[model samples]
Target chain A: DVKVTQSSRYLVKRTGEKVFLECVQDMDHENMFWYRQDPGLGLRLIYFSYDVKMKEKGDIPEGYSVSREKKERFSLILESASTNQTSMYLCASSFSGANQPQHFGDGTRLSIL
Target chain B: DQQVKQNSPSLSVQEGRISILNCDYTNSMFDYFLWYKKYPAEGPTFLISISSIKDKNEDGRFTVFLNKSAKHLSLHIVPSQPGDSAVYFCAAIRQGAQKLVFGQGTRLTINP
Candidate 1:
């Protein structure tokens, strides 16, 4: 089975602080994505990396950034944490194809104070 | 512009009864669609999928139907069990695209 691991299951941070969420995939997939789940908003993509050092902005990319320095690791960075940024963040990985389904991690519930 | 939409916010059904979840898309470029089931505090897992070329696909107790002309799809679960209760999200990917656009999702509850 494909396993996507998120570094944090839950996190709390104060406003204006920088927060990082890490994700690693064991399946060696070529695509990685970050998304935030909000009530009545579903899962909105923040950023996605199709290859190492390559990134693309998704629908909601403001207030966030991503890094994919290596093939297996992807990181999401919050420029400055805010209360509105508090959400369940999900990391997913998949192969380079239109038919492949992306495998997701358990998600990190971040609370900004 | 919410390209993908799940009109129903929630659905309730009795145990051993059939559960039908609906989804609609406004994008004509989308050629593939998928359904995912998510539990609280966990991630959404892939459930079933259907291609725009095919109208229906079935697996065990789950079935997916696609209506290309209407840009609509539905997931049918036969004899739903209590464990089947979860949030169902419908997602779509445009032709040759790797990114998927998701709907707001519908919460499913199975009552005994």
Candidate 2:
């Protein structure tokens, strides 16, 4: 079985604070993704990394950045947290293929005050 | 524009009955479609998938039907149990594309 782990299950931060969400995968997959899920909006992609040191912006990447210094770890950074950024963040990983199923970690519910 | 759409926001069904969830897409370029089930506070889990070339795919208790002409798809869960209660998301991907476009999702509740 593939395991994806998120560093935090829940987080709270004040406005204008920098926030970091960490994710690690044990399956050695080459693709990793960050998504934010909101009520009535479902899940929207924030960013994705295809390899170490490689990153690509997804649909909604504003106010967010990503780091992929290593293969097993991917981090999502919020330049300055805002109340609008509060959402359930999810991390997923999958093999390098067109239709490969992605394995996800338990989401981190973020609250920006 | 939202490429994938799940118009129904919620559905309720009695246990041991069939539950049908619907999804539609506007983009004809999408060649692959997937269904994911998510529990509260948990990320979406890959449930089943079907390719554009095929109209139907089935697994134990779960079946996915695709209609290319209508650009619509449906997921049927037979004998839905309490454990099957969750939010179901429909996602699509173009040929050779890595990114998946997801729908708004439909929440399904099963009554015991």
Candidate 3:
């Protein structure tokens, strides 16, 4: 079984603080993704990394950036946390194939005050 | 504009009955479709998927039906159980594309 693990299950941060969300996958997949799940918006992609040091912006990448220094770990950085940015964060990893299914980690529910 | 849409916000189904969740997409270029199931506080799990070459795919109690002509797809859960209740998200991607577009999910409740 594939396992994708997130650094935190729940988080709280003050406005204007910097936040980091970490994810690690054991399956050695080549693709990693960061997504924010909202009530009406569902899962909106924030950033994705195809390989080490290679990242791409997704639909909702504003105020967020990503780091993929290693194949097994991907990190999402919130430049300046705000109340509106509070939401559930999900990390997923998939194989290189186009039609392959993505395996997800248990999400981190971040609350910004 | 939202490329994928799931108009129904919620659905209630009796246990042992069938539950049908529908999804529609406006992007004609999307050639692959997938369904994901998510529990509260958990990330969405890959439930099932169907490529454009085929119209239907089935796995045990879950079946995914696709209609390319209408750019619509549906997921059917048979003998719905209480454990089957969750938020279902439909996603699509164009062939060879690195990104997948997701729809606003539909929450399904299975009543015991």
Per-prediction CA RMSD (Å): 0.5, 0.6, 0.7
Candidate 3 segments whose C-alpha is farther than 4 A from its true place: none
Candidate 1 chain B minimal-lDDT segment of 10 residues:
B44-53
Please provide TM-scores, in order, for all candidate models, with all chains considered together.
0.99, 0.99, 0.98
Model 1 over residues B1-112: C-alpha lDDT tens digits? Answer: 9999999999999999999999999999999999999999899999989888899999999999999999999999998999999999999999899999999999999999
lDDT of 2 at B59: 99
CAPRI-style grade of the A/B interface in model 2: high
Q: What lDDT tens digits, residue by residue, belong to model 3 across residues B8-58?
A: 989999999999999999999999999999999788899999999999999
Q: Report the TM-score of the second chain of model 2 against its true counterpart.
A: 0.99
How accurate locally is residue A4 in candidate 3, as Cα lDDT from 0 to 100? 98
List the candidate numbers ranked by DockQ, top first: 1, 2, 3
Rank the candidate models, highest TM-score first. Answer: 1, 2, 3
Q: How far off is residue A63 in model 1, in Å?
A: 0.7
Worst 10 residues of 2 chain B by lDDT: B93-102
Q: Write the residue-wise lDDT of candidate 1 on A20-91 in tens digits.
A: 999999999999999999999999999999999999999999999999999999999999999999999999
Residues A13-66 of candidate 3: C-alpha lDDT, one tens digit per residue: 999999999999999999999999989888899999999999999999999999
lDDT of 2 by residue, B1-112 (tens): 9999999999999999999999999999999999999999888999999999999999999999999999999999998999999999999999988899999999999999
